[model samples]
Target chain A: MGSVFTPRNLLVAGGFILIALGIWSGEAGIVFEKAIRVCLECIGLG
Target chain B: MTRTPKIINRLIIQVAALFAYNPFLHNFLTGELYRGGSKYLCTPGLNCYSCPAAAASCPVGSLQAVLSGRNTITSTYVVGFLLLYGALFGRFICGYLCPFGLYQEALYRIPGRKLIPSRKVQMLGLLRYPIFFLLVVGAPLLVVDTFGNGTAGFCAWICPAGTLEAGIPLMLTQQSLRSLAGILFQWKLFVLILLSALSVVLYRPFCRFLCPLGLIYGWFNRISLHQIKIDSSRCTTCGACVSSCKLQISIHTNPGSSECIRCGDCARACPHGAISIGFDIPTSQARTVTRN
Candidate 1:
């Protein structure tokens, strides 16, 4: 109950919101996947 | 951890997810709010792909294919989601979002041993690295066809999630797939059954050792914007928090260890109210430190 809206919560909540928005807007799993692709592209790992 | 809230939260999600057959709810907000294409949004701990309501993709399954990528970069999306989830949630995603984690908890309820501690347990934890590198990463490259679309290694060969979601459903619908099932399918089913059995005695065995997503998320626990704070002045060091930890942590010994999921159990456990969850880099706290 105490400090339920800490940064971690906000980040997670934001991540979930982005995901929902992506799907509802017809972009399935786009947020997480976009980040992954960007990272992999950066590292040349993908 | 008492696990009541965790269990109840999972139960509620399961009921809502299963409402696919609940025609009454289908006409209302629950159906529209909780149905297909969105599972890629919510990361249920269970890997319950069969559940009617799922938004986000199965991260592990995605990684397995991407790692064992054949044609296109399969893991690109999976890795992105994982990093975001990890950076955002730290390890709480395992507690609140993973469908597989929920399933493991349900299996663990009929417990006998409750926990088994060992060096082997620690050793087993290391296996994830190789699993992440090879199955999650390596095999896909080797096995993928000329076009390059790789098989979802862990899911195709070993993932419990596929069995829970795709495997069970495909068998139920297609008689031929049930007949087409062979040693590999049986092997995964066996693993699922064994993990389910182990859950009664062990807490989150998969999360501890096998899950690639858990591994990915755990890496960010230490540096995530939010952190579990241990006020040394208020702490008694009685180690009550350590004993209460189901994740095999000693909060007094290492309050900010990577194993922490930031579920706030230690905070809840401390009678002295020594623990609090906060963003480690608050502007005010940062400024104070800078001044000091």
Candidate 2:
């Protein structure tokens, strides 16, 4: 929709792919849960 | 008109910090950190998942998770989002936004250390890249236990942004949170305090030394739309702007340094107005040098 092959454009596209891959494969959820667990552990909730 | 900028800035500050408070945005609050980021490349900021008000995912945390790769390459959500953000905004995300950067900038307002001379600033500035590579990525895997699990080294141990926004507040309110306090937490919190103190005396110690996002963004500084330029015709090479820069780049020598955040301080400080930030160098802008 805009300029081709710029850093901003590339990164945005890449970011979208990451989000999609993360959600579609459920991999995103795993990372999210793990991250939350680690962070929660910091405060001893985990 | 009088309060408009203040109101806007404050609102931005709140949105950046408190969006999680809204129930509609709660997916961002409770969803996996990488889940939200994998979906949409949220701005790189200190917005925390645990914060009652934060709805956006933390980018660096998301990055670490992806790099560590929980088995396979993880997911597409993060990549898609990052592509969109990086494509649309480039490094502008670092400037004019990002709550953690804003917080550090605010702390820097404490006003003690004079902006260091450009030469020394340039010398020390080289350290940020290696730190970004080693601490942000390498440390996590290397520091992992026999279970073959890794930690988000930067977030778990060093990032002041996490400490200031997530760790401290959560710990202060929940008494049971005291159980989480350990030697590692205390040690990391101490690092946060040191960075906070440095922010008062210096400018963005973390951004300059340890921020992976800044490391990423800084790579695009020269090509980014919002860029810094030296009006070569106007420049006397007196180096005043160089000394004035908190990021410590030699505007006279390298006007478009990767480390330059395009903060406008150098442009504003120039006696001859020899520096300007824009998409391209100005062929004709005002040119004059005055007595010191």
What is the Å distance of residue B79 in model 1 from its true position?
Answer: 2.8
Poorest stretch of ten by lDDT in candidate 1 chain B: B25-34
TM-score of chain B of 1: 0.78
Q: Worst ten-residue run, lDDT, model 2 chain B? A: B283-292
**How high is the CA lDDT of each candidate model?**
0.57, 0.59
lDDT of 1 by residue, B141-242 (tens): 666767765554555556776576546544555565567666776777788788777778888787787877777777878757656767789888888788
TM-scores of chain A, one for each prediction = 0.54, 0.56
Give me the runs in candidate 1 sitting further than 4 Å from their true place: A1-46, B1-53, B66-76, B278-292
How many pairs of residues collide in model 1?
A: 37
RMSD of each: 8.4, 6.9
lDDT of 1: 0.57
Q: Global CA lDDT of candidate 2, please?
A: 0.59
Report residue A26 deviation for candidate 2 (angstroms). Answer: 3.2
